[model samples]
Structures are given as C-alpha cells and as structure tokens.
Target: MRINMKPEEAKDILSDMRDQHLCFLESSENKDEWKKKYLKEAWACDSGAKALEKQIPCKPEEYVPDFPYNIFSTQKCAKCGTPVIGKKISKYCSECGQKIDWGEE
Candidate 1:
C-alpha cells in the first residue's frame, strides 16, 4: 500500500527528520561515527546536498560554572539575600520568601 502527501507535508516531515538527525549528531560522543550514520539516514531520506552540508561535524560540550560554595554555605539566598538555612536552591528573601527577579543581565 502507498500513501500520497502534499508537497508542504513532505517538506515538514523532511525538516523534522533533519532536526532529529542534527540532535543525534550533537549528542554523539564521536562525530566520525555519527557522520556515517547521518549520511546513511540523509541518503535514505533522499535529502539534498544542502541538507547534508548543514550537518554539524563536531559536538561541543555544554559549559557549567562551579557552584557558588560561599553562597550555599552562608545560608543566604543568592538573589534576595534571604537567610536560607538548608535551602541551597533558594533565591527568595529569607523571611518573606519573595523571589528576587534577576532578569537576564
């Protein structure tokens, strides 16, 4: 059995597949291994050269800053200066527990 889809539907499906492929590549420990898999999948989808060209060849590790030891141990909230005895993740005022809105700075 076969099914027919509109051109727009096909495009959407292809786009979603490409995004998934990109995500897989991004998570791969070894990019060379992922490259082979990506190419094979792209060929199966009959993707254009442009799509293959857009494939990322390298995966970057995300950066995370060290936890603020001073703040966590001090029992004070990082954002609101509230006394946080055991709440290490607390960001609100100690007494009122009001959140201190620190907008992207």
Candidate 2:
C-alpha cells in the first residue's frame, strides 16, 4: 500500500513510531532484543532522513544577510560619516561617489 505524506509529516510519523516502539520494548521482558532491532530500524530511518535533508540545498552564505563575521571593520567615512567597510560593502557609497577609507588604527 502506497502512503502519501509530506516529507515533514512522514518524518514526524516515523519519529513518533520510533518513540512508541522504544517504549514498548522497554516495558517488555525481551527488552534487549527489541531495543537492538528497533534501534537498528530507527538508525536506518534517521540516515534516510539525513540523506533527504542533504538533497535540499540551503541558501548560500553570501545570499543570506546577517551572516556571522570574524573580523568586523566598523569604519565611518572620513567626509560623509557613513558606515562603510567589510564584506557587505563592495564599493564606495551609492549616495556619494567619495571613496571610503577604513583606516587601520
């Protein structure tokens, strides 16, 4: 039988099933055997989800704003008092054609 479910829903269902199975195994006398078998299956499901997760490419770092920066250079324009410097600033100000000098102080 074919089951139609969204990826997220499928994952949630699988996780719930895994939790339920684990609880059942823990309560039963044959806990060790069930635990091993259930864990193996759960691991397989987790690996499958991981593989699927990798298939969906996330946005590139450059495309995302507010990305973390190690060395942040906060410099104001000597003439205009505009904050300019770092990876976000590719060129001189769009407002003024004046060159921005991030002095190394």
Name the top TM-score candidate.
Answer: 2
Q: Deviation in angstroms for 51 in model 1? A: 11
lDDT of each: 0.50, 0.52
Q: Write model 1 residue lDDT over 38-89, tens digit each, in one string.
A: 8678655556433332331221122233565544333443433444443324
lDDT of 2 at 80: 49
lDDT of 2: 0.52
Tens digits of per-residue lDDT, candidate 2, 1-105, equal: 998876556666666765776676676577577778877877776665554443332221222225576365554444444555564353454443444333331
Model 1 regions lying over 4 Å from their true place: 39-105
Best by lDDT: 2
RMSDs, each prediction? 17.0, 15.6
